[model samples]
Target: MTVVKFLRLPENVDLPLPSYATPGAAGMDLRACLPDGDVILDPGCIALVPTGFAVEIPSGTEMQIRPRSGLAVRHGLMIPNSPGTVDEDYRGSVKVALLNAGKEPFTIGHGDRIAQAVIAPILKPQIVEVDTLSETERGSGGFGSTGVKE
Candidate 1:
């Protein structure tokens, strides 16, 4: 298990730190830290909700903020940039940008689970320029070049 050190802002003392909902869960639930109560998000609108916590992510790893499955299926809420990355060098409060796609306005209350944080390993590969590349059967095929097959 990787160790992630966190700092809770003064205004977020009442809020719980992000945690895995289940023993086998791959990500931890990140909660909203609204200082002014509930926030209404209209259809096609986006809001950057603060998580009230700053993290010191270990080197060689990154924290990816992702949309929750339940919110997407039930409320049509999603992260504008899915899997938003928090690099190891960042030391600011973690936030999630949520977009409301549903017809009705969605209310985001304080301490509500808004997103999930997934810690993943990062790999930096050295770049090398090549004159020509090997070709495959589906070479130069873009988009639906490969038809759906069962």
Candidate 2:
């Protein structure tokens, strides 16, 4: 397990820190740190909600911002840039860009659980120049190349 250090900003001093919902949970819940009462996200609109904290992530790893399953299923809320990556060297406040796909508007209140963040290691692949590629039965087939039904 990797340990990440988080610094809470002035606006978030009274808010709860991000934490895993359960013992088996892989991601930690992130909350909205809106200083105002609430913000309304109209249908088909997107808003960047601040988490009011910056993190010190270990090198070779990234923090992935994700949407909560309950919000997506019940309110049509989604993270526009799903799995948004926060590089290890970044020191800016973490924020979540939430998009409302439902027909009605969604209200985001201060300290509301808006998203979840997961820390994962990143892999850097070596790039090599190739003249020709190997042949295969399904070489270059994509976008439903295989049969839809079995």
Candidate 3:
């Protein structure tokens, strides 16, 4: 298993570290580190919620920050950039950008599970310039080219 090192900010020392909710969970739950009052997110508004922790991910891997399904379904909360990438070299505080899509305003309290992070290997493929390219059956089909009932 790949290990990730985390540094808790002084102000958020009382907060719990990120943890997997279940044995088969693929990502670890990240909590909101708000020291002040709750964040009130108006409909169609976006907020950068801090996690107050910096992570040291192993080389060749990245941490993907994703929205929690429950929050998305129940509160219409979403991560604008779903699966936000945290490069291995990043050592700054982790923050999740949340967008409220619901009609009603939503409140985010401190220690609320705002997002999840998954550590996965990254592939860096070499780029090459070629005059000719191969063609396939689905080449340049674009959106909706494949039938919906496939």
Q: How does each model score on lDDT?
A: 0.94, 0.94, 0.94
TM-score of 2: 0.94
- Per-residue alpha-carbon lDDT of candidate 2 for residues 15-85, written as tens digits (9 for 90 to 100): 88899999999999999999867999999999999999999999999999999999999999999999899
Error of 1 at 147 (Å): 1.8
RMSD of each: 1.0, 1.3, 1.0
Which tens-of-lDDT digit does each residue in 1-150 have in candidate 1?
779988998779788879999999999999999987999999999999999999998899999999999999899999989989999999998999999998999999999999999999999999999999999998899898888895
lDDT-based ranking: 3, 2, 1
**Clashes in model 2: which pairs?**
none
Error of 1 at 120 (Å): 0.4
Whole-model alpha-carbon lDDT for candidate 2: 0.94
Candidate 2 wrongly placed segments (more than 4 Å): none
Query: Candidate 3 regions off by >4 Å?
Result: none
Clash tally for model 2: 0
TM-score of each: 0.96, 0.94, 0.96
